[model samples]
Target: MDTNETTATTLQTKQHFEVLDGLRGVAALAVVTFHFMEWVYTDSSKNFIGHGFLAVDFFFCLSGFVIGYAYDDRISKMGILNFLVSRIIRLHPLVVAGSILGLLAFLFDPFGGHPELYSTGKIILTFFCSIFLIPLPVIADRGFNLFSFNAPAWSLFWEYIANIVYAFVLYRIGRSYLLLLTILSALAICYIGYRSGNLLGGWSGPTFWDGSVRISFSFLAGLLIYRSNWIIKNKLSFIGLSILLLLAFIMPSSKWNWLSEPLVVLFYFPILIALGAGATLTPVWKKICVFSGKISYPLYMTHYAVLWMFGNYYTSHKPGTTQLVLIVIAGLILLVGFAYLVMVIYDIPLRKYLSNKRNERLAKQKAGLI
Candidate 1:
């Protein structure tokens, strides 16, 4: 009702960085392709898009930048509980859907060869845990990794952790202290990469610390980018930037150049986000950016379930290279379609419902109608 309230509301709903949104979509697609390549090659070293896993790093950076942009100042108005609830509403719908799909896949293909995982009890436990976006411990006999239902959900678990850190810790810290934390995280990422020869082991039991380092560094880098308001006012197109991102992700890792992944996460991605934030887009490009960003999270969250089912069939059939290419192309199309469907039918609607409920509750509270 007042000027301050009006200003806060405007900041909350400000227009996003279109190029960054499109880039997020680009990274998500690369991740899907990367998973397919993993299925085809079966050897991590031989996969063409071996660096695609870095897309998760990219997502972390983007998330940090966006969260800072959207919430760094507004946290005073919204409070930590409101911010956490907002994040849950934004992210948890697709998580539940992905877990349900994983459960169904496990049911229909109960004998997909992992005998320990076929038990109904484990499947139900996994489903329930996944609904809450909780990462389960890896039970080797049950084929359970960090997240049994959806493997990629491990990253989301870490993302939520980062969000918590942001609200309670990072957001309140002064810029100098935040920079110190970021530097320390970067050093840790470099150390981990140097030891492992690549930024690879973040998704499973043995390397959960690696995952923490990866998210912490990149997410802080993103926050720094936002806080510094770094930007490049060049005429860089989203298309060009998107292509560059694809190349970055698909680039092969070299044993001789073990520092590449860490360098990209520590330095390159933050620059990319800054440039993306600064760049301008045409009307058509803006539409593409909106569409791509809309589908990015859904695609990331849901595609793994489809891959789980397809991986079994592909392994048994052992298709030739040509057939594999076609299958991959078809799979990409199907993934896009399926992600769009989930976005339309579930994600958007559920978020709207939750958002409305929250608003109504807030209004009632204001009117002393608790």
Candidate 2:
């Protein structure tokens, strides 16, 4: 533990975080694939390669780990308000922009299709649910129904839920208690997912409870990984991915399905830890994954809308595979471009303003009278 060794380790850790970011990019791609391929998935077998929904889970778990690492000190000292402000500022701007874009996309579908998709009830509800990030099954049941708008944003609801739990319960209780609570909560979600009959109902069903129960494991598993100091070294990424793939395939689709939920929960933890670990272990991975991580949020938020726009255009023409591929590529380009635009225009500026305002108010309050 001399200075040289410490210096080398520090550099490695920084590199690893960059790789974790790249994995975030990978996760983003997964979900985007899932969205783009949803129409053709039946033909492609149930394998569902894009299965980006799983990426959302990865993001949540990653968030739990990153938040634990990033704000453990802040939570320990200045408390929850500042922690919450930072999160809100970071999250809300993109969310708002995504929602607006989604609304516009749905409103102007290429075929002039499903205008009522933006009916008063639906529009108001979607806006309201999104504002709170309440995992409402607003449009998922439609199944290739691009009209419901902002389909992927559903996961953000659970993100908010997990954050609330983290801020109030997990942080206050300390890592040990947080671990206990996460385990217990994960078990509860598993039971609910099992009892509720697989929990993936048609878009018409109530989304809040079903999705929250199904995905809480992602967040909890993340917290578990973060609390353990062993994860810092990059020893476990591929081993974790293999286990998840094995379980995802071998595990039956049966309701409650034996160890399905727990398996998923178990599989997810290691996969993410391994992802974080690999960045530490390998330089190449670190370089690619970190770039992906930086654009990950915007990619996740904008991809669905971009897909809907381009996918609708292609579906109308009934293009050849080459055309579809070109369209898909175009869609991806637009997705990333739009995401970056929203991030730069609405997301970054508002976040800076809000964060600054919050910090200034906090500073003033500390001096006595506000």
Candidate 3:
């Protein structure tokens, strides 16, 4: 293979690692605990589990970095249309499947007849908005909220929007300018927090934007790390991962998890660095990391529903310790099962097809066959 061909091949290898998958498992489990623990145990009991939502932040960083690393070159070369098509193929199928499940969930009222829970109007709105991967406009008076149909779908909206922003705005800017834009984005988030009177825009500033700031910044960091070819090639991913874990442990006790914001941002830097450096590292850590990464998405998407199921059961039956332990164990089993289904039936096939298509198209373009 020529130099360019060899480079592409290497990148493909990075894309296929098990560590990223393992991280997915970890992220998903965190979300599960975040959602269900409160139901099984009181808030005081949930002290250990309450922070599961932060896993989404980790996910955002991972998504941004991984997507950027995977697609920056193609996006830079092929333009947004190609990028959108690829994204749609990669993300939309599962999204549609999830939406259908959400609709069924709403109709059945799996969350319960808290008539205040979901509205038909909000359900319809969330379905379409989520379908298009856009944030539905907030209709505060309507009782139905972004958490209406599929609460998790909201994040996907941010993910898609961030992808669009990257393609049109960040990716085109020179690397130095991209770094500047990232800093500005983080500051923008903080400013929005102050103005909205909530660090996460409590009820003001659009919900979609709630996580966009972090997503954009972390993603840009990933791209920069990749372009620089710095830590990954130097066997520093282990160091980076260590620092991130240490920071997460130490950073949360401050006022309001006040340190959480910056600490998370700090934590992701090393993760992106490590992932970008995937090519050169053969650390034993690679095995564990990749496993978590692969299941992360399914773990993420399915965990909420799993938690909800457990909560529903617990609320009605009020089981004891054995049952609760069984519930947790069952939830983990369910997550694994669901992740396998998603990976085998949904994620893997679709990803392979889209990638293969991209490769074939690139080959044809090289040969002027188009």
Candidate 4:
């Protein structure tokens, strides 16, 4: 998931919607739990959080809503170049760090598998490409997929494409046209999800189009929700909303007669976002929201690399239920701690530095000093 900022005017006039922020964190955490379960079960159908990958779609919708909320008013003034720069500053730092972590993990376990898989030169190449969020071609012989260092980076690549679409095309379109696009994207989502039998096909090379359709539908739906200024007026419980989101992710797709993923993406998620927008939090809930928002992005971008480490350990050891449970508990703590540490030590500081640099550059450009 990505974080977005408000325009100067919106910043002055609009209250930050903390519920959406908290939901993002909730979804990220679900993803982490899902991955942990996936490694343990090694069977998608048997996994506990069977539909947790839907969190990625939730993330796409959230990104669209926040981006539209933040930038819709200022698109004309900000210009495409500036908008792209702003997104890069917000998203690229953790991406680079994640890739580096992935590379280190690979280096430490280079000989664990087929020695011919990734040569040192190939690993270095993957590292360099990953920093720029490039998806390398999959090497079937070696079982390599794009962003080999960190698989989750695949979503960030699509997110960048969606950002470009927003800045260049979607921002300028009339509401009617945008609505048409949203409807078409929704249909695409249903069709793709039905054909694939699941919504989990997006991270690999052959199924990249499946991923594309998934993002397009959710992102556009989110953009439409923001543009329509839709929100539930009745007081909604933050805890209730949180539970609904978790259930949406945790429920098995087959439990809803195999229609859960499509229904959730096409209807539930957008409705959820609207309801979340209207949520008013108590002081305690407010702090929860703030802390959740602070760690959501870092958790998402960093957890997979840690998971890889966990997977390595799991494969090497044989543990009983109690021992396995302890490992899971400790792993969760370590993942959360690492995500927060990255936020405090790297993500926040790097974004701030990049933002300051962008401001300086923009100042220079305005002053004809560039």
Alpha carbon lDDT of each predicted model: 0.84, 0.61, 0.59, 0.81
Full candidate order by TM-score, most accurate first: 1, 4, 2, 3
Reference-based TM-score, model 4: 0.93
lDDT tens digits, residue span 1-370, model 4? 1112345545668778898888888898899888887768876667778788889999999999999988898877778988899889889999988888877766665324332565777767777888887778554422355687778888898999999999889999987898999999988877876777777877777787887998899899899999888877648777788899998876754644236788888999999999999888889989999899888888888877667666766767756779888988888788889989988999888888888787777777777998
Give me the displacement of residue 201 in model 3, in angstroms: 5.6
Clashing pairs counted in every model: 0, 12, 23, 0
Clashing pairs in 1: none
After superposition, candidate 3 runs with Cα above 4 Å error: 1-10, 13-21, 38-46, 109-111, 114-125, 137-147, 189-208, 232-254, 267-291, 350-370
Per residue, candidate 1 scores C-alpha lDDT tens digits across 64-114 of: 999998888778777889889989998999889988877666556632546
Give candidate 2 misplaced runs (Cα > 4 Å). 1-16, 43-50, 116-125, 132-148, 174-176, 185-204, 232-262, 281-287
* Top TM-score prediction, candidate number: 1
**Predicted structure 3: lDDT:** 0.59
Top-lDDT candidate index: 1
How would you encode candidate 3's per-residue C-alpha lDDT over 72-158 as one tens digit per residue? 666655667877777777777667666655555545545443435557676577668756655554444212345444457667777
Relative to the true structure, candidate 2 reaches a TM of: 0.78
Model 2 Cα shift for residue 222 (angstroms): 1.4
**What's the TM for model 3?**
0.75
